[model samples]
Target: MDPCTYKRYHKHDQDSRQYLDHYFSDKSQMVFGEDALIFPIKSLTNAFAAGHIKGDILLDISHGSLVHHLYSACEFFKHMIVLKIKDRCILELKRWTDKRTGAFHWGHAAKHHADIEGKSHQLEDKEVKVRSAMQHVVKCDLEKENMTKPIVLPPADCIISTLLLEAISKDQDDYIRYLRKFSRLLKPGGHFMLLGCLGETYYTVGRDKFHAFSYSDDFVRKALEGEGFIIDHCKLQKRTAVSDLTDYKAVIFIAAHNKK
Candidate 1:
């Protein structure tokens, strides 16, 4: 399925209760492994907090509304721009950042991130920081040459995406094409961080199923290298058990830099 249809299937916060509960809840660790979302969040937090990666602007390209992946890393950048495929997703994110009524509670994820940083008691503080760092939540069309058209954005120091390409690409070729489009939004030597589900073809948002690209570490490595990125980090975390919700074999996280 293309991004537009995929966007219709995708929901965030309250609308994505089923998706969040099935894939991101703490209980998922018993079936999907502890590192499903933990590894990427903690790793990015550690890297940025330690000065291993430095950046002034960070852009998050995600299918639905997802701020969990940006919580920790947002602290490292002065501005955070979120590019979403649908206006609904953008609105959901804006509700949270704008502190609107009935906003989905991200306290759980924020608390988890804070605990990882050895500040378990500062959940509220972390939430505030994440919200403050979220400077923009904009609409984007992935299939277009300029994803964020009409309003030009400065080249980002880092571009981060999670499970975005997998849900949008029809095959490896499409994945590469989308990857190159993302690269164009980054400055030279800028970092690209991605999280993907390995060997995944379909995932559920509510009652509907969405397509995801099936990929391996080798496929990903070759793709990034072929696009002129220098590999900085690569890791694959195997699943503990299989779930009917998805057919992913493992969770993969990669960090690479655009060649200067």
Candidate 2:
């Protein structure tokens, strides 16, 4: 596939519903349920529960309108500010957050969170916590020097971005450039958690193929190091699902703290 033929995420009209159904629906048998959903949920829950990441403010810059990863995080942070690049994604998230009539049902994801914490009975409460913690959803543009631009945000105690860098970046330079932008959002010594795929070139969503920047674990470590972040914990899960929706060799989770 030609690089120029790949659809640009920010410039295209993405079907948010199709994205949710393809990857996050309870009945769907896609690999995301195992690799993307379960892995991040378990990893984040464990990280938060162990007190590895705790703060008053958390800035989340994730791809799509997904909220499964924030279930565990809501409990640890007093406030969460989500930055989205697309209005469609923002609307999709608001549907769930505002509890609208046709909101996407994330009950299964909530249950998974509760099940892991052994609080199956409080499944309903889990979603409430996530909604409550998400205080703001702001629009962002990665190309801007200050992604959020005119609306300056307070430096966060921790910043978490899941599968967003690769989705938005067209190449390694773009990836590193965006990484620097993300790093600027955190305070000195603040933690940063990143979740992304390894060796992925493309992912399809609702009949549209989006480019994914391919990078290795070593490259990521060096990237963080170059940005003055101290590596703390890193985990890699080998791909186990058979699907044509995406071509990812593995999923990686890295937790680090900025030195500056």
Quick one: best lDDT, which candidate? 2
Instruction: Give TM per candidate.
Output: 0.89, 0.96
The digit string of per-residue lDDT tens for model 1 on 87-178 reads 76777778888999967666767877888888988888888888888968888777678777887989999999888888778889989999
Query: lDDT by residue for model 2 over 1-260, one digit each (tens)?
Result: 67568786777777888888887888746557888788998888887877868889999999899899899998888999999999998998999999999999999899899999999999988988999999599999888888888999999999999988988888888888899989999999999999999999888887798888889999999999999999888999999778888898999999899999
Q: CA shift at 214, candidate 1, in angstroms?
A: 0.2
Those runs of model 1 whose alpha carbons end farther than 4 Å from true positions after fitting are 1-17, 25-35
Per TM-score, the best of the predicted structures is 2
* Candidate 2 runs further than 4 Å off: 1-3
Candidate 2 lands at a TM-score of 0.96
Q: Which ten residues in a row have the lowest lDDT in candidate 2?
A: 23-32
